[model samples]
Target chain A: MARFKFLVAALAAASLWAPGASATVLDNVKQRGVLNCGTDNTAPGFGYLNTKTGKIEGLDADFCRAMAAAVLGDASKVNFVIVTDKSRFNALQTGQADVVFAHTTVKPVRESAIGIDFLPINFYDGTGMMVKSASGVKSVAELDGATVCTTQGSGTEATLAAFVRARGFKTTKVLTFENLEKLFGALQSDRCNAMSTDKSALAAWRGNSGKPDDYTILPETLNKSPFAGFVIANDSRWRNLLRWATFALFQAEEWDINSANLADRMKDESAFVQKFLGAKDGFGKDFGVADDFVASMIKSVGNYGEIYDRNLGPKTPYFIDRAGTPNAMWTKGGAEYSPPWN
Target chain B: MTTLALRWVHRNLFAKPFDAALSLVIIPMLAWAVYAFAHWALVEAHWQVVGGSFKVLMTGIYPADQLWRAWFSVATLCAMFGAGLGLSVRPGRAASTVVALGVALTGVMVAVAIDVHSGMLAAGSAALGVAAWCGVHHLAADQRIVLSGLLAGVVAIFVVLSPPGFEVWGGLLLSVVLTIAVSILTLPFGILLALGRQSRITSLRVISTAYIETMRSVPLILVVYWIWIIVPLLAPDTSVPGLLRGMAGFALFFAAYVAEYVRSGLQAVPKGQIEAARSLAMSSWTLNVDIVLPQALRVVVPSLVGQILDIFNGATLVFIIGLTDFLRAGQMILADPQNSGRTYEIYVFLFAVYLAIGGAITYASRRLEAHLARGSR
Candidate 1:
């Protein structure tokens, strides 16, 4: 009897090695009835868990839901898998996630070496500096002789060094710490006159500070760091599905459609709006998804502006202004322009 | 009474002039630090963030409607724990009183801090605790029955929890489940490796030694990462759940350490006993099974308990593979910019919880060691 039990256990363990391969990610996701969307659980505004709601609610999280809505026709069919900055690409490559919307910056080396295709830039961020309001500094230009602190081994360190050199600030000093907590502490204790990092992170840190009003983020950005979703490289079917799903958010904003009025807009006489909503001659069928994918996605998550307003807009705690930035709509003279739907 | 207290204080704190001076300086600093911490924790800290986010901290993003599954899992665990305690060591009066006091304090704090709905769950847990105590005190069940019941409870927890799949497992629930699964799965493998290490066969000894040495030399995170990345590639058709892969990696890595511990226990067993059994015409299998294995396992129980605690603490590393455990859940809560200022309160709560759990395990292992020693003597 013991020998038989051992045999059974050995077979059971061996069965885990059996090949159960499936088709592409799209088909697997559809068959499984859920989209595994990778995101950062710790990134405020981009992706963070809303403790009160027992749900992940942020711009990147909303985009995950949007992708789920586009593919599965139910935005609630998304299971968020948290990915850290270092692990996001590996997650996609290993097929651990269907799509990653973890505020990854689009870089050439990432695409070429990491072998992952980036979607269109959804949130444009840049290296920026912050200073104490009482210090009487208004912009990066005025910090000529200031000492700046940033986290070590981050792109911000190199960016700060380049910014200081390019601006020809003779006495400006750059100090690096092992992590954000120490850098923030050094800045708070007057060890550094300024702190530099990604603008979004700076805003989040400022908002979390004891007195948010004591700090000011400079308007001048050092360099562009456009954030986007990414997927395993060379799978155009899966890649295009995610890319167009992101583009639909931008298009929905241009078409003046949002979650609140999606139902009414679905009945609009305009052929283009109807097509975009997948009501008439929709693109979902061509993309191997449901015809009403866009409409369902809109009803579930909302347009780009609504997602922004809900997560990072003035009403939210982060309160990052979108005006005069690439994040704003192109019609409003920003860089967020989508290709013509036709 | 005042004079007695003064004498006690003098002996403990100010017996010598140097001691008195050191006490004068350190006492005030310690008092001030304690006072400041208490003021911050009880009077000044915004505990509402913790209260509001308590559910997420306990079970991150677990569907709210299916929360009863988690509660049932907890109740089952309590019953299993009670049965194990009953089988191992009957609670003395002092131990019972301490447990009762701890439960009472926890219940009162839960009632004060949480809303009515959550308070009802706490009340239910308290009721289960009472029931567990009663069952243990009165049942007088057989050891095998209690062990089977505990095994059943583990199965029931998996059945109740796995319907949501491994992806939904998060927070403390994920941590506890992972630790339990890895510890249980590693035991048999560990024993096999230990036997192989001692085998006279060259091939078996060499392979076992190589595996144990290789696993022990690398960091655990690297093992988890390698398994997570390489396993899928090796069997692309087999879509193993990330949690299971992680557990497998953890078990495979820790089994080496467990094997070494068991090997020490094996060595500690008397050579005469094995020779006597062989002289009595007992086969190697019977000798090892009936005599050597039981005595070896008994000798290593305390170390095994310590390893269990280590695995529980090590479950925090799962977050590297994107599975949210207890520590990551706290980080998720702090990630909310709205609750950023409550970092101290949240971290304190996490620290207290880890300390409580780890301390309890250490205490239980010490008790078990004492009990085993008594039996041997």
Candidate 2:
């Protein structure tokens, strides 16, 4: 029995893992003519598949599209793989997808040990709480005996527990659920006094609700979180290329360059916009892409501003204003500052 | 002649006033179901989009070049079922109605499915009807055992032939393959554990008990995760695929339940029968092979059928491991942005498939139980 099992195992291993799954993922994707970029299946501010449009629309979806545009030249030339928190890393490891834009926070445990590299942070967010105005729960400290609902298996659960404990608030209780939608429902149903998750998620959820005024998301960040994107580790070539490609959006936005009026702006010969769009800059060669790589990315998906507006903009149900968030341009006091284009 | 037909109805339906009242209520419910299903299936179903995405619905993201493997695999299973029917009594009118209903449903669906190019679908179903009629017309006793064995083997061979790959596997095909794989791989181990639990030796009993208890106590997800996580940690020689891990988890978890059922069958075998074998100077192995196992298996046929049903339903647990089973594929269709509002349509389609499968399993098990119960007298 053991020998037969061994024979089967050997055959299966030889069939699936040749050299490594990671090495072939990129070429396989290129040959397939669609970048199978991974993204969150249901994160509100990140990757959420819109039922109305039949397309995944969110900030994370934009990042995946941008990556596809950088690699394949067409932003729409991508297939989206829905990755959840538990299987997200495994999906990348097993060659199910080329990269993940699944709102995965960078942790030391994930970066080196789990075999995936984090791209630059797309959304600098932190945990926050939302409460009904009628609940009289003005601040985190004010809710001593109140039950707070949070999504299960997230850092929010632990943080809520620790905060309640350390503050010597004995009457406070924490509740956890598998999904934010259920957690929010719990809050709305008066089963819990407050709902807690990432601040951006809270913003999106509250805004997406038809009765947005019924709830309010507090500005207090319960915990610091940076939602970084990732690709399989051990491929520095792809890593460097993806990182610079993302930063190109930040640089474009900082220089007031967008999809609309890019040509008109480019003819100014400011050298920065020209160099950034790869008119004569030597950066694209360093990344093994065309000289106009960033130009292709911006042209296809538009600058980061345009992508943001289309997905999570104030005009949408989420109605998010990007002007004050850390996702704003560096010159405007947000953290999306890019190193100067040569 | 009209009065005679009325008399027959009165005898069957109005024999009891209570039964007549119940039928009155049930008839409307039945009519409502028929009306609703027929109208939606014909008038409301968006067949144009569905027809266009036929290849996607069937093959998922599986590469077109490798789809031959899936087709061949499916055909092998179909042939096995066809051969299995050769061993049994011809289906009665009730059984034939189910078969006819399935064929008719498929016919209506295919007709609606293709807008401009529905070529051989209705004809293909008609051909299947003819083939099934032929099979039911000719079946034998000795052929039954061979048919069942081949059915099992066909499942095993098809799963193995999936080319050490997952791309050719998707949709309902994935569900059927995983269920069969679990049942086949787990059967022998289940037998061993059952025998070991019934063994006179203390060590074997203790080991078997521990295994059965541990497996039955844990959730299916935990076992699946163990296969994914622990195999890489402990086994230097094996790198388990996600689908294999899923199947192994299902088998290990379900084998315990199957063993208990088998053990009950073993206990049902009379002690006198074993003593009689021993008196004839038969070894334990010979006695078990000749006398004990056959009777025990016969006694447990219904229970084994029940276990198979459980295994079929349990196949859905593979979705967490990222293998697209039927339910997961249904969910994937909903992932299309355009199909978002069509949740009711998609879910109704899934409900129909699951209902058909579940009904068949339950009906088979009940029939087996009725047959087994007769032996007690």
Candidate 3:
């Protein structure tokens, strides 16, 4: 038995020393015929697991499928590698995952220190204040001497402090609660004049609070926390392909071409539309994907707006208004935009 | 009969004035709580959420077509469990009847609640278990055969399930597999550590003590997370599956505790037993394995069984490394916005399952302790 145990240990040790592959990530993904897309399972409307269908369904997960469609021409050729916030970057760095769409915030430090390059911002989250509509406090400026509440130990506390100092609010006191439930409770009980948190979380709290109309979220965002999918750093080949694939989603929305209208757009007589949709000419040569990779992606998951609506639209409980936020398309007055497809 | 019932109730619940008053105060409240729970469970709760995702709850994200592999693994496990039971002392007639009734109840529930195919597979597995028990119950109990059978069963389960990839293994299936693997693998590793700690060789004793103390001092989550991270770094080419790494972490951590339990058991064995074996010119290997281990193991069997529950509970921490064990699977289900309103229903279901499994483990440990004690008595 001792000899057996020693043999087992030796075998395990022997297996560890083999050299890693040197192929580019894109090439390896293509050869492997599947994409390992790291994402969270707990975050609702982002990378949640849909139990009824036994499939991962959310904006982040769909983005993974879109990447799979762009690369493998089959949306289902991707595996949802469940990752936590702590392990997400490690997963990408270790080659355990090819790309991660786990709603990670785009911070300069992360990009500078971590061996990962950020993709285009998919969702722009920021601290926002909420007040009871009955209070008639329309904006943060109106809360001159009012008490504000936020979850304790969160970044919002510091951000709120900065905002209060910057705005020169003389008597605006910030209160902290243990969690969002308690913070919202403090606001509801009038213990605080307003509640502050991420705009997305604020929207979710209001939507699920059973009295959404009674509360109003202020329009002013306290700080920027734009989220984006990312891949390992210095892999420009894979990085560019994923970057353009995400851009394709934005451009598809801009062109009003979704999964529903993609067929009709394919029949468009316009040379630019044809080329953009890969009907006449193609962009796949530079990207090293199929000529119709964008079309395939659209057909699989749809445009950015459609994907967003599918996960975070009014039909879902976590509805965050996309009309006025930076998450909206550039054709509107929001920050999401794509470069010229040509 | 009425007087007899009254006397029993009076003796048990109302022997003293204080006891009577306490019983009066508590009984109605307990009754009200039970009634309220029953009412909510029967009428208000949305059980459709649980019913609809039952497969996911049982085997998270395991491919639908490859479900037979999971079922095969389950059948293998059930057969192994039955064989183990058969190797033990046979239960009394009343106990057998109770077991039979429980099986029947489970069958009825499965038939009514599950799809026909799943129900059939479950029935087949149960049948296999009974057959295995009948095949071995009357024969002479052989520890060697049982151990070899368990090892074969473990190998068979992995052979059947690994084709679908280990990462996709989740839900209760993942929890059970991790517990079983950790429990079995920890035993020998722990015994070696215990023996090493007692070794006269100074280096072996020092190394064993350092490892055991270090593992016991740190948190299990840290070990699991680091192993998950470091294994890939150490073996950059070969990607070790996350489940295997998680299992390794669990085995490494629990082996320390097991070592402690076993070391105490080793101490409990009389020094005279070793001396007697040595006088008989027994080899060191035979002395330890035949004389010392059996006596030491009998003392520690109950504790070792209890450790199975510890391992099962600890398995839930695998979520940090992103493996969806049972509790994490429930969280995954709740993460869906559509099921957000059914939080209580999902949580209640998860609580009930954990309670049931934990209760069974405790009961089994008690039974084993009693069985082991029978010899001394």
Candidate 4:
């Protein structure tokens, strides 16, 4: 029995380590006719599985479809690879996924050391605190001398301690747990007076709680948390294609070209609008993708506002307000700016 | 009857003043706890959530059209399990009665939980299971043939399920697959490592010692993550599926601990057995294979069963590498904002399932241990 076992083990190990040829991610994706876009399958507003339709639907999911539409002229050509927070970077690095949109925050160490490049910021989130509404705490100032809970080793802990100190709360104690579930449990059990994390995450937790209206997110922002999609380093062709595809979503919103009215706008005589929609002398040829790539994308997954309204708008379950936030359009006095299409 | 009951109560609970006080306090508390749990589970809980998410919880994100594949896999497993159990051990009347009651209760629960189509499929599978059990009982003399047939069933399941790619495997299906694959692969690797550790050759001993120590030192997560990352770098063209990589890492890591257990078993085997074989002019291979291993493995059957249980529980960790196991599937169900505030209900359902499966495995191991002990005597 022992000798036979040894033979089997050796054979299995040998088969796993066999040598094979490699190819560039761009070539592989093009040949496969599918863009493997990794996204979070558990996040509520950003990316989530819709139980009714049995399809992934959210802001991040829309971006993946748009990328596929831009590159392959069919939004359905995308394979939505589910990635968690820990595996997102590794998935991109190994060419298992072509692009990752797992709500990754832009950090200098990730770009310099991990060998990944971030596109323009798609969503700007910030750290905030939430307290039970019954406590009559409307802002961080009211939480002096109270225990606040966040995940251990997360940047939120340090940011929370700094905020408490700056406010001159001598008795404020910051408690840390290993994960969000425990932190929420601590707050629920009255072990902590408040919980601090990214506002988007707080919203999701609050939405999932028994009484969403019972909790209130404090007004003051503790820290910045701008998120963006990323791809592997040193692949300029693939990188540019993903970057421009993201930019096209915002540009479409700026040009008033949405999914519902895209065909009508295509008939406009303005040279700039015509070029923007890839009617004539389009810039898609310069980028090495399809000439009418943006048009295909808009037709499949609407403009940025439509995507937001479908996933995080007031009508949706998440109900995230984008009216006065940086996610709003530039014309509406928010920070969503688009570069020149010409 | 009243006099007898009073005597029993007086002896067990109220023999003295202190005993009476303790019984008065503890009995009511236990009764209240049971009552509260029954209320929450039976009446207050929203079981509709469990009913609605049943498919996703069974096979996450698998194509709806391909659901028949999952049912087929389940049917195959049922047949194999029935046949194996029928051939392995004979139970007395009391044990057989208990098993029958458990099966009847499970059948009633299934009929209540699933739709008509699924109930029909389940009934058909149960018929197949009954036929397998009867057939195996008649052919119990050819144990080798039965074992080979069971092994072929496992391979057939893999062939039917592997075509959809590892990414689509999620929920309970992923957990069962990972546990089975790791359990099958670990035994052979473990035996080799144990022999290497016990070898007379200096180089083999040192290398095996080093491998086992290194694997035992690091966390399972790091080993799994390293394999997930390094495999692609080593063979870029042939992308190994993440699920397979995770299974390989688990098998490798677990084999080390299994090697230690098997080594203890090897040590337990009397040195007289080997000396007797040598006196009979038996070769080392035949002596070890035909004599030492059978005894050693028999002594360690209980430990191997425990290791398999550990593998099943550890399957939940695959979510870190983006593969959803049973636990992660529950979280995914909660990820839908509409299912908010149903955390307790979802968690209660998951707990019930894990408890049921774990309890069943433990019961079988206990029975096996008893049977083996009887045979040795």
Per-model DockQ: 0.44, 0.13, 0.41, 0.43
Q: Which stretches of candidate 4 lie over 4 Å from their true place?
A: A1-24, A131-154, A161-195, A210-220, B1-26, B91-104
DockQ: the better of candidates 2 and 4: 4
Clashing pairs in model 2, backbone N/Cα/C closer than 3 A: A54-B337, A54-B338
**Model 1 chain B — which ten-residue stretch has the worst lDDT?**
B80-89
TM-score of 3: 0.89
Q: Highest TM-score, which number?
A: 1
Better of 1 and 2 by TM-score: 1
Error of 1 at A221 (Å): 1.6
Error of 1 at A302 (Å): 3.0
Weakest ten-residue segment in model 1 chain A by summed lDDT: A12-21
Give the per-residue lDDT of model 4 (tens digit) for A201-247: 98888888857777777766788888899887766777888788788
Best by DockQ: 1
lDDT of 3 by residue, A96-124 (tens): 89999998999998888665799999999
Candidate 3 local lDDT, residue A91: 84
Classify candidate 2 by CAPRI docking class: incorrect
Q: Clash pairs of candidate 3?
A: none
TM-score of chain B of each: 0.95, 0.81, 0.96, 0.92
Q: Candidate order by TM-score, highest to lowest?
A: 1, 4, 3, 2
lDDT of 1 at A126: 94
Score candidate 4 by DockQ: 0.43
Error of 4 at B191 (Å): 1.6
